[model samples]
Target: MAPPLLIFLIMIHGVCSQKENVIYSPSHICALKDSSVIMNCTYTYPTGHQITKVFWTKGPVKGVEPPDLSEDPEYSQRLQYLGDKQQNCTIRLSHVTLKDSHEYYFRFITDKPDVKWTGIPGVTLNVTDLQVESPERVTEGDSVRLTCKSSCTLTDRATFIWYRNSQPLTERRDRNNELLLQSVRREDAGRYSCAVHGHNHISPAVQLNVTYSPRNVSVLITGSGEIVSGDSVTLICSSDSNPPALNFSWFKGGTFVGSGRIYSISKISSDDSGEYKCRSINEHGEKYSDAVTLNIMYPPRNVSVSIIRSCQIWAGGSVTLICSSDSNPPALNFSWFKENESSAVGSGQSFSALQSGRFYCQAHNQHGSQRSDAVTVTVKGHLVILYISIGVVCGAAVIFMMLVWRIRRMKKRNDTHESQMVDSRPPHDRHKACDVELSDPVYENVTADQLDDCKSELDSSVYENLPHNNKRL
Candidate 1:
């Protein structure tokens, strides 16, 4: 019985000598910058026990004794008594800079004589500079990558935040901490930075130098073909770049010609014809475009003016005043000027003006421009009057001939009618004498003398022929 009782007493003594309970508010060491930071700890003791005193201390440095809350005068101003004997314990450091970086330990006591607790190898605080990384230049329609690396070894888990042009970006984990810009455009070309949030500490800014050249460069001419002298011509150069173009220059015949995107030649001439080039430059690099050539041909010549007539155009008849000029490569423009007003005409060799007056034409080609000598067109109004008079005279002659033909026809009809009338009239008494006349003539007045003559003639003949005819039986 005595041996058993002695063994129980030793067991009770072993239980009473066990260590007190303690737990830190924040189990991990936190980092901070030149700003505020919070540290906390919590613990649980036997139910009957109550807290009496509580304090905080710094871990032992080198071989020196750990800081004591009751005796240390140097830490008094900086130290805080945040622990509640009955509830919780936490510490806050304000205006914390690099110098405040150190391990913090806590100590506590309870009203029950057997209960006591102390912090179990507590946390360490580190203050560091903010992190900053920025890109210098970015081009339009390009993807950009920026990386933000920790200057110091970031032992704890940290969050990285990215920014572009001072605007906040999405936060991400420390690993794979690069900001990726998908299909970056000109608007994305600006300063970029990253912020590291770990243990409540932010790092300093870091700059990234990025560069790219112009893209999609193009050249355009306002008008194609040969540019005439004394005519303004424009050549336009365009490109896609960030921060806009720094400089634009034009070259002709391998020599710098102008200082703007649109190079204008106030008076284009044959001398202006050459291989023209344009170059655009930015902070990134220089870009050159393909060259174009201008061809200047011969000036206009053989300027002649005339009037166009249709049929027998009399005075007051409308006619066209024509001016023509010959030029190589054809004329680019033809203008008709009347009075003080000028209007552009067709590009053909001739131009016409309907309203005749003092008029002329000017022709232009790539080489030069020419103006014809002015001519005055005199329109005769009396010719129309003469034509009308001649027409009237000819019409009268035709009418006179027609009247004579009608009169002759009427006379012939009248003569035919009279002849018919005379033929139709009855024959008179001449016809009655025919039968009686024949009866009266039969009674002879053949008288005696005629008989005597007949006898005598017969007698002579008888005497002569007496012998011949004796018998007259």
Candidate 2:
């Protein structure tokens, strides 16, 4: 037992005389305000003594006998020791502040009253309250810089890490503390933060606002393609930007029409047809939208009523009155009007001419209506024409009668000439010629009394020339 004690004593004495090595990665840390932090530490001691206690010390009253974090008023509920006395000594502090920034050391005690050690050159905690230093507003295409700041100067050199919208950004190693934006745009806007490289605890995110001019501007219109005169319409202006647009303006062709994000026309007209655009303005800059076209339709114009073929119409005769007009929707409804009449005389594209005088027409549609200029419609007289027509017909009848008489006389003369030619021809020899007569049987039909009267007029030479059988009769 005495030899064992001696050996133990020698080992203890050797371990006590040797210095312990303290290992703590990232000697310097940049922590954000009101964020959780971890101080990681581990140590080695000679192989003989039982460890009793381990604790941390930092901040305002740091050098003398320091207070235990477990008992401190500010850190009692928000601090946790995650390590044991053997070799590991790490702690977690929640909701850290600028006051937490200081030099920190880890000290350990053993069973022997005299065997106590504190690791010098311990982990250096640099609680840097990161702040984004940048201009409040900036215009698009403008160059800008954002700086990351710390509450206290750190003894150890550190590399800065930048985050946007809680996500880490890619940048060259040379740009560690500041972020340079060559041309600020609407996409380059979000919350920003900074932290030290190789440190898990980051600074409280400070918002980085990149102001920019309006872009991708356009005008939104709501109206029908058949937007007629007197119809209502609305126009909206839109743009992409950082922050809100300050003002809006509207233009029609070269004329300044109105202002505001929404432009309204209570009653549109034909004059409203033109090229239109919108202008957007902000603290950053101004931008214009692409041009759009606005068209206002109307019912009809230049309506008129005219007589088909001729303006003159005979009494008791018929004529067509045609209505015409120029209209956008092609004048679906038409009406004919007479002078000095309130109501329409007829309702159609054409009307039959009755008692004609002065007439007009109206063309109408859903949009509006138009009336035509009056035109005179006169009824022609037909008394002289009727008389001339009767006289001409009588003359033609007389001429036709005379032509008939002449034709009859010519036919009679031809018959008489044929008869004379037969009688005057030299008689053929009696022996060779046979007599032939073609006539009505007047003698045969006569009674005795008629025969006696006709007997005196009869020619006896006709009987004398008869054949021998009738010679004496």
Top candidate, metric lDDT: 2
The whole-model lDDT of each prediction reads 0.61, 0.71
Superposed Cα deviation of residue 182, candidate 2 (Å): 5.5
User: Per-residue CA lDDT of candidate 1, range 8-69, in tens?
Assistant: 55443322123344555455554545455667766556677666777777765666645564
Per-residue alpha-carbon lDDT of model 2 for 1-473, expressed as tens digits?
34676755544332323445456666667666666778888877767887888887664355667667778798788889889878788888888777877777677888878776666655666666667787866766788788887776654566888888888886633335788888877577777777767656566676656666788999988955667788899999999867678699999987899999999998988778888999999877899999998867888987877777443343344567888887776887888878898888888788876665888888898778998888887555563476568789999999967855765565466446645655666645221221332122322222233223224434676434434522322
TM-score list, all predictions? 0.48, 0.56
Which 10 consecutive residues of model 1 have the lowest summed lDDT? 429-438
Local lDDT at 354 for model 2:
67
lDDT of 1: 0.61
Q: At residue 229, what lDDT does model 2 achieve? A: 80
